[model samples]
Target chain A: MTGESLHLESVAGLVRGLAERRFSSEAVTRHFLDRIARLDARLNSIVTVTAETALDQAREADGRIARGQPRPLEGVPLLHKDIFCTQGVRTACGSRMLDNFVSPYDATVVSRLRAAGAVMLGKANMDEFAMGSSNETSFYGPVRNPWDTERVPGGSSGGSAAAVAARLTPAATGTDTGGSIRQPAALCGITGLKPTYGRVSRWGMIAFASSLDQAGPMAVSAEDCAHLLRAMAGFDERDSTSMNRPVPDYVAALEAPVDGLRVGLPREWFGEGLDAGVAEVVESAVAVLRELGAEVREVSLPHVGLSVPAYYVVAPAEASSNLARYDGVRFGYRCKDPRDLHDLYVRSRSEGFGAEVKRRILIGTYALSAGYYDAYYRKAQQIRRLIREDFLRAFETVDVLAGPTSPTPAFRIGERTRDPVSMYLSDVNTIAANLAGLPALSMPAGFTAGLPVGLQLVGRDFDEGRLLGVAHRFQQATDWHRRVPPGFE
Target chain B: MSLSDEQVSAIAELARLSVPRDALRGLAQELSAILDFVAQMNAVDTSGVEPMAHPQDVPQRLRPDEVTETIDRARYQAVAPAVSHGLYLVPRVIE
Candidate 1:
């Protein structure tokens, strides 16, 4: 098969191609590595391109296939968002603090995928420490949207989304603390799943918010996502919070009919702050779901608006605690000559962390500080429970909730940088899922003004199979997910 | 909701991040904007609601204390910015 042939193949397609000897895993891995080297500079989507490791892994996969003992993802190449610790690779987490920090161990997600025979093409760029919505916060630099180079790709999974959208890799792993996965997937016109919190292991996934962080798959279609999720999600003893529930056959459930499926349209999602174009696209996508025999109704999630505020409080509070481990004492960036531990801690952190990360750490410190913990942190936690309860009540009458994944399509980079709150609002529609600890997916719904829009479908906890099935059915009836970016093709 | 420069500096100090004199003013502005936004939570009467720690209320599982990990002190120290004889190096706390 030609190198271009690798672009159109799904995870399953690539696996089957390897099994059929249509192409060696080495060939497939090289094809993607070449694509990343050739195309990634234009998008700044890749931080590292591991050609040597990829080829070695691919060759191992080919040997396994030759022995008639193929693993599920044998020969499929993928990009991991730099947030996941890759054993020997520079898992920078898009921050200068860990710029030279080669991880000593693999994140569970990374090891699981490797065990399933997926080849790692290298790490994708992201918002520094998974803090931004626009991917512009990266210490390396912002990742440009594949559709329009001048525009931002939604982030902190922006690199993963753009890599998959541009077909640089067949699938990629992304972690969503808030909307990092789904928002980027929406903006980049790809499929991304943020499995129910605890559905995937957090061990070795650098934490931004312990309660909200979840690793999931970003791919071209829900079917591709399902295949990847099957390998990525499961119980891990390493992550104490990792759910022990049996992993469902997500791939087999992809073709399940959506007939009689209840899709609740949150009234709050369609209100003000939603771009008219995105809303129209989402409306038509809902129509397609309706056409496919799913019932749609407007449901009220009264506390949905509070998700942003509550998330700001909760995520930063957790971030402050999680990031404390990065002081000059252990690993990561350190300061020059220090007078004492005080100077070492302060200078190392202030100099090493980017502006956005510092802002969050400060916010978190303030929120969790002695006098303000109850008014800010505790209040936010109560609000989180309310948000979760709102979703539970909504789910009583609907199997999934549907909305526009982001308020708008990819905005121009630097548009919201002046106002951090504006940047925070980009996640308005996507944060509730994290707050509720529910499985949610964003898929290409349609394009607006030549840019792609995404429809977000959220499901009950551990109900990722049902969500994937719904999205797969939508992809079957619509060509949105198949549409490639202009020059990417 | 507004954070004074002194307050911003205090927060930065607590977070162990050195705030440059000029950056402090800007940090104060940004922090105030964020705090004011989240202050909307104060309006809601969470009178009886318990502050949630974990999303799922499941208690953390405990296992019999056993050695599950082998120490790779050298490998772990490789990434450290400064390390000494089987220990992480840090600025001297005592003269």
Candidate 2:
């Protein structure tokens, strides 16, 4: 196939093209560079573009081919979520606090991807410190949905999601603390996976909620994501939370049929705020699975409704502790008038953090405080157990859980910005997966009012391999993932 | 879940934030609404439930307690707002 055709090809096709030497890695890299130049200005989706580095890596990949060496991702170009720390490149994390900060070390995921020979296409923008569910909190500004510029692309991994959705990059890394990856992927109309917590290393990723943070793949289709994740995931000594379990060969079951597999739909997800269109799309997605030899059943995750609240308290509590280091004393934002260490700490953090971040931090601090610990924080933890139990029990009767990724499709930018509660609630269904520490994915279901809606499939812990298998099969049966945003093209 | 204005103000202080009085109403209302949603946990009976902090049952990976190397004073100071004699400079706390 020609270079133009390859640009829009799935990551599996890109890897195959590189393997056959049909077109040099440099040619594929340049084609995407040209596309980014043409379209990124309008969407502002990609914050830091690494054209020179990408070309350099492409040449090295071609050199390896000259020597008759081959690797699965030898020439694949991938973008990274700005949250991960790259040794030299600016990893913005969508915050002014670290706007100019350059990390001296690469996160385990970055190093692993590089070792896999994936070409770096620079870092994508995200919610500053990976804090917000919407990209608006980013100091770099909001990433517009590729489907419609007026709508949000979702966040805190908005840039990664947009980059994958618009075909600016084949695959990108995204961290989900409380639905960051899944929500954004759902909004952007791509397949995004959040491996069970600790399944992926968090070594140099700027911490959000340490307990909840997980990095995984965002791509046009599940098969592509499987390849991308295979390259980036594994246990690392540097991350205390990194799981030591074997990284399963995810591609083994890409074509596996799910005959009589039971899928549970949580009652909490379909309640109140779910827009008719999004609910319709997700319900039809369940039907598609039913037709493909799966059984759909309604299930109750009684405590699932409390996930967002538990998450708001728990994530912020962890974030507050993790981010305490950025007090203008070491790295990141510092105030101009710092006269002493205390002033520096107070001003640096107050100035550096955005409103939503401050709000969450407040909630977290209160939850963890002396008199309120049992009332807020400990109680939330107890509720967290019930959410996990709900999922665990449901899994005994179901192969997987299904739901709409968000209550609504991509909403107009300013519409939800004025209401933070609405924005936080947008992550409702997806948070339970994080709380349960289960692998969850968001894949395109269908469109509503011309914008794409996402369907989330959550599986038991360490079952991402099966989740991808299910998603790949679903993608084979559908064409929604192939639809591109009109203006973006 | 109905966080009062005083509660929001108190929490902000604990988190070391500087919020103006006028903004307290909005923050309180929003925080209250969010807390209301989170309060859904109160309806469930979780007496025997054990709270899980991480998804995996795998034990936390730990580094040996041994020191890796000497600290890089210069690099550490690079991001500091003000460092004097390998120390961060700060405002005077003296009376």
Candidate 3:
């Protein structure tokens, strides 16, 4: 392969090419930064560009190659969701409150990615404090879909999705809490995966609902996601919730055959709200799986419809607690006036957060408050268990489950922003996976009325290997994942 | 089913959010719509059900007692709004 071939290559392919000396890491890094320069202006997908530091790291990677050191992602260029902390870099979680906050230490995931030799291409924008489903809540500005600038790239990982769809970076890291990763990938028409909750370390990623928050990857293909997940995952003693199981060779699983795999289509996922066009494309993707020698059956996760409400209560109650640290005392934005200690606390917070974040804080406070805890927050937790049990019962019969990643494809910018509930509904189709703590992957299935749709593949906890194999076989049978957004070049 | 202005203000205080009074009505309206949507949860009869705080059945993991990590306050507090003699400074609470 030529050095130019490294430009749009997947993580696995780029690593292969660079390790073979077909292209220097410097040339490849320069190519991607140049692509970002060319394609990112109109998309507004990147929040900050780390070109200077990325090149410095690429130079170090080249020296490692000279030393004959070996690692899987030695020369790959990657972007990060702004939510993850990077020492010395402004790690804004898309909130005005943290706009000036620079982290003191590298997040565990960032350190691992660096150890694997992936160059930092800077941070992608997300919803402020990961509170909103749409990137509209971001302090920077909403990210435009590279496909049609008029439409939103699904968020709160919208920037990461847009960059990959436009090939700004080969792959990037994203955090999912209530569908942030998969929804944005579906809207932008790319591939993304959210591993089982404990599979990836959360030591450095900013907290949302700690129970639902997880970090994974967005890329052009399932093969690339597998490689990125391999580097992003492992047991970290620092994160108390991190699972201490043995990490598998996720990329190797992609090459496995899909023979005899049992896939279940939950009856609940195809109900009243699914867009007709999206349903049609999803059915066609199911047909392709049957053709690939996989067994397909109808299954029911009875509590599926309850995921959104459960997520709303659980996530906010946690957020209401987590965001208390940013009271303008430690770092970032602060108020100019302080009549007393109480005034300082109130004014600093009041001035720092925007409408959407404050709204969630209120909602969370209500749910967990003295009178309503039993009625609202407590009840939501009970339903959450039933939701998990529904998956457990289904998984007993099927190896994997499939659903449409969203009710519809990406909508126009400002289409659902005015109605906050509608924006929250965008995640309705994807949140069950998070609530169940299951591994889920979304890949481009087809298009509807010119917009792309994603077919989500979800499996039992720690079943990322099975999910990747299923996605890889489908990719081999179709070319949808290779389809880029219009005008990306 | 909808949150009121007073409710919004009270909730804000509990959550440590400092919403300006002018923003309360709008906040109440927006949060009302979302709460109304989530109110669907109340319709289901979960009387005898147990509330689940986690997805897994596993117990919480414990770490061995050791001095594994520490932060340098002098360096960390370099960015504080106010710090003095290795302590963070704040507006006086008591007269």
The DockQ score of candidate 3 comes to: 0.73
Off by over 4 Å in 3: A1-5
- Write one digit per residue (lDDT tens) for candidate 3, span B17-84: 66678877877888888788888887788888878766675666888887877879876886678889
C-alpha RMSD for every candidate: 1.0, 2.0, 1.4
In order, candidate lDDTs are: 0.91, 0.84, 0.86
Encode model 3's per-residue lDDT on A426-482: one tens digit a residue.
998899999888889899999998888999999999999888889999999999888
Model 2 residue A12 lDDT score: 84
Ten residues in sequence with the least summed lDDT for candidate 2 chain A: A337-346
Give the poorly placed runs of model 2, Cα more than 4 Å off: B1-10, B57-59, B67-76, B84-87, B91-95
Clashes of each: 0, 5, 1
Q: After superposition, how far is residue A469 of candidate 1 from its true place, in Å?
A: 0.3
In model 3, the number of clashes is: 1
**TM-score, each model?**
0.99, 0.95, 0.97
Instruction: State the lDDT at A84 in candidate 3.
Output: 93
- The share of true interface contacts that also appear in candidate 1 amounts to 0.87
